[model samples]
Target: MSKTILEDAIQEELSFFLQAIHECVHTDFNCNRVLNNAVANIISSVVSGKRFEYTDPLFVKFMKCLDENIRNIGTANVLNVLPIVRYLPGDLFKFKQTLRNISMIDKEIIRPFIEDNRNNYDDSNVTNFTSAYIKAIQQRRQEGQNTNMSDGNLETCLRDLFIAGSETTATVLRWGLVYFLNYPDVQEKCFQEILENVGQSRRPSMKDKTSLPYVEATVTEILRCADIIPSSLPHSVPHDVEFRGYTFPEGITVLPMLSSALHDPDLWGDPRNFRPDRFLDTEGKFQKMNEHIPFSLGHRACLGEALARMELFLFTTSMIQEFEFRPVDGVSPSLQGLPGIVYRPQQFNMKAIPRAK
Candidate 1:
């Protein structure tokens, strides 16, 4: 089911990219907006069984809200440690405002879909996550089992899946473009690999990944350098646990410093450099490392990791195969982007020159 959804999304994403480039009169474009909408549409289809056009007003507003809320939420905030801080003015930390914005999204954006799913609930036909959840709630009631799949809970879950699943992938792609623009040689290598593996007559797929080792390594390097989610979400230690001679008591909040491993000098030599060769073995094949935990580790790792991987590979290869990305007007974009919930590249324009077939 997930594979089908991703395959459909990759096709749509490639079409959207082509359309965006064609519409650019001067060949100048904002890759960030195009990438964000492309990714968000995937989640929109999965969660609500509907995909919105890029220019849809309500959909644009919802995207804006998600972007703002994500930016407002950094690695860690004082509100998490002190509940009293939220009682202060909304302008102080933007905490209350962020919550209010998200609540509006839940009420205005998610509630309507939940209502529709509930009204049209069916036992056998489960088209999307919303429908499957509604069906589960009904089935649980029929069996008289204790289930918490209430409308509100369902709405929150859907919202989480939509935002988390969309924004992270979009940010990573945006950064990927930035890196490629900064390093044209790397971009050309990726394009060459894609061309040799998957010809211009067809779109690239997961099967092409093995044949395009450099492309795979390039994607790995982009994720390592971008560090979208530098700090994983807060995880609680259930009971007193001791690891490496350190005792962590029960109920302690643990923040997995992923950057520590991703940028470790011993693990990754010259970890600060944007080099895809680090992920490639001497034989020119992609090398998988235990330290390469971009989606993170453990059972509670990213639920959408598989989908994200497919999106990254397919969308990136499609773009490289179709266009040669370059900085607009010979202006280079800064690598150090504004850090929010995710590390985002700076707002910079770029040109996607069509490649000769």
Candidate 2:
């Protein structure tokens, strides 16, 4: 798709999200409405073979469940360590229970489809990822391969993909907006670059990203400063592995601290500041840095990296090109990151003023 087309899709998706939020806000005081709207949009986009939109009903429901689960999981972590909280619980244990309920709902959504197509597969309705996987499993089974296309495994994979992709991307986008509002200079620079390089007639494209080096750099810097995933997902060492003259025993849970590496002063000069220039060389070309790995690294790196990158590039560029982000009057953008499974900007509001030309 052309850059303009992709951007239009993103704008539409955002509009849908806002509409969903507005429609449900009175009835649903919790953020679950917003979450559901976002997820539903994604689901509709994937299923309908259109650009992802967050306002779709299914997506909104899925997002609500996902958000509840994430919050519940976070609470569970706290309660596991702080026994007092668990013992005196009214809503404390309920949080973990909510996660279980969400998990059951996720399985309910995915399981029936897998079971129905376990014997005979239909390729006609290959809109969602679950359907695609079902088709693949059927094909593999027909080829005499003993593939375990069980409902349990399929549900697990789908659940993981949904949670991993939706939460991470959404959190990053939230942080990007927060930063843009806080740093007007940076935001204006990005807006000017997008307008000058891509123009209003067309939306920003991945190809245009090369010409718009500063825009790309701004994104990289946002990811760097945001430090979305502070630590890599836990992994057990396969065997006795020696790294930098330190030998770690097998089966030891290893947590690679990504924040330190991304923000290391030695690796990135003055890493704390929000400097997009750090991602650019003297010649102004986008510079590749080893310290940059917002999606983690190695075999366990995110499988949705391509999709996430496309979403980020399209959404960030389009938003900046169309609107100037600034903090609401008398309100300062909160830079404090909310502690969660993925670190994200605290709740903040910004005015998206339409850009003329």
Candidate 3:
């Protein structure tokens, strides 16, 4: 959809997200679930012209399933290489369960949502992404032009929007919090940038992005360092190819190790360090590097890249303005992340200390 639509969605849901944190904040608080719900609501807002209350049953189930599928992806992907193992029985790889998860999501969430959008198609006012797609299909049919905008494709797009859009963005946010816990100085620096540029009276917006170079750099660095979707989605070998003294057979699954590019030593001399300044130029302005590919590069890159960038900046700055993420008992969080479909931080506890005005 359009950038304005996504921006509006984030701006609207951000209040609820901050409120959820306020209620849940304590000596030991895990904001993961609430973060997921908030991001999902943004997707819901864009997809169906609706947003779910954090406590709603469907909203809860929706967040749970999205998380479950992400948790399952690492294990389920193994069946891709050893297809025969599925016949051996049991949900060892969770491949069957992953299928079941998708079915559940489609039945309980996606199908009903898409059907509702179709049943209530509004041509005069195409608000959300689904309605907009329906409008396009209708226009195509009226013009007597065949189009691939079928219901099945619409369903797949909706699925991609929900799963990839929500999970990756939310996971990156979580990783950012973990990093903040580990590097409070960097966290404070970001907060200072927001405080100085946007101020306490106003919320940080996309307009503040260019003015807050340090904050922007921190977000960019988080995306680069987290590199959550390191291998990206698996792709089949298009043809026999030769690499550095190695050959791959056609049809073999190639997990492009995206981390290699992101963590390349030549690009960042000290790639292992969590230094946001690496993204800043000598004049202290945020500058992007061609080697950075957290969303994966080329045609297979993420569809929600723009939306993801907006969410990252808005959520990161807003949260920092509201609270200082701290480790339990002043201890630092481990930077090592759990590798899966998305490389994410291991479950960790931290406190969100509200900042003084």
Candidate 4:
């Protein structure tokens, strides 16, 4: 049953991906359009009680929305970091106002159901996460159980999931592209490996990963070098713990230095260089390293990791197979990433020459 559900979810997500790709390649796809489309798609899927599929329009819109929202939120976060902008009296107010507006929109969308459930909650329309959560609350209420679920909690969870999942993945992709442009040899080697292993007729699938060592290595290297999220979300140590004779007090905030792990010399030889071969064994099989923790490790690791990996594999392979990325004219691609809650490549232009079939 669990496998079935997981498969269904994967199918649904793929449907949305297809739609977004269609828009990305054919339409005048901008950041906003992509984001709005993805949002609409996710909402529709939840409402319709259908499993996500790659061909679904909702999936397409969801991907677009996901992409655009990342770009917007990333920009806003960077601007907010400026000492002058941080001090601007109006900026905080504006941010709060914008957040309130978002909350209002969310409330309005779910209001009708809330009112209907004030006395007796309905389950028919509970397809998405919000509705599912509401239904769970209602079911507990019907059973005469004390339910502590609140609108505030629900809204916060939903907002975080949407924002984090979207922005982090998009930011990673942006950095990956920048790295590819900076190191064309690495990109070419990756493309060749993918073509030789996966073939050109059908798109590369997750199962093909084991057989495509070079491609997998390149992806790992990209994540390691990108280090999009340098400081992971704060994690509590739970109880007092000792590491290397140093005692860490209980309840103290522990910031997992993700970049340090990624760049650890013990695990990676010449950790500073962009070397995909580091992840490949003598037999040309993909090797997993303990230091590669971009999605992080332990219980609080990213929930959307599987989905993100699929996206990275497909999108990167597809784009590189189709285009030869080079630094535009005299302008060199910036290796220095713009720091934010998420690190991103500074706005850089690249010339993409379409590859001949």
Q: Give a tens-digit lDDT track for model 1, residues 114-163.
A: 88877887767677789888878878999999987798788779888977
lDDT of 2 by residue, 1-357 (tens): 233443444556766555544454223133334543454455335423344345445545655676777666766777667767755746755655766666665565556545544444557645455567767777898998988776577777766766776778778778788778778889888888887788898766777878988988998888888988899688888899999999999999898899888889998878888889888899989988877998888998877776677677777887777666556674656888888788877776555556676
Enumerate clash totals for all models, in the order shown: 0, 9, 0, 19
The candidate scoring highest on lDDT is 3
Q: Which residue window of length 10 is worst by lDDT in model 1?
A: 71-80
Cα-lDDT of candidate 2: 0.69
Of 2 and 4, which scores higher on TM-score? 2
| TM-score of candidate 4 to 2 decimals | 0.72
- Model 1 ranges off by over 4 Å: 85-90, 120-124
lDDT tens digits, residues 132-163, model 3? 98888989999999899988998899988888
Q: What TM-score does structure 1 among the candidates reach?
A: 0.92
Full candidate order by lDDT, most accurate first: 3, 1, 2, 4
| Alpha-carbon runs more than 4 Å astray in model 4 | 1-89, 92-98, 104-147, 150-152, 330-332
Candidate 2, RMSD to the unseen true structure: 4.8
lDDT of 2 at 207: 76
lDDT of each: 0.84, 0.69, 0.87, 0.64
List pairs with backbone clashes in candidate 2. 4-203, 36-60, 37-54, 37-60, 39-59, 40-59, 40-60, 41-53, 41-54
The regions of model 3 sitting more than 4 angstroms off are: 236-254
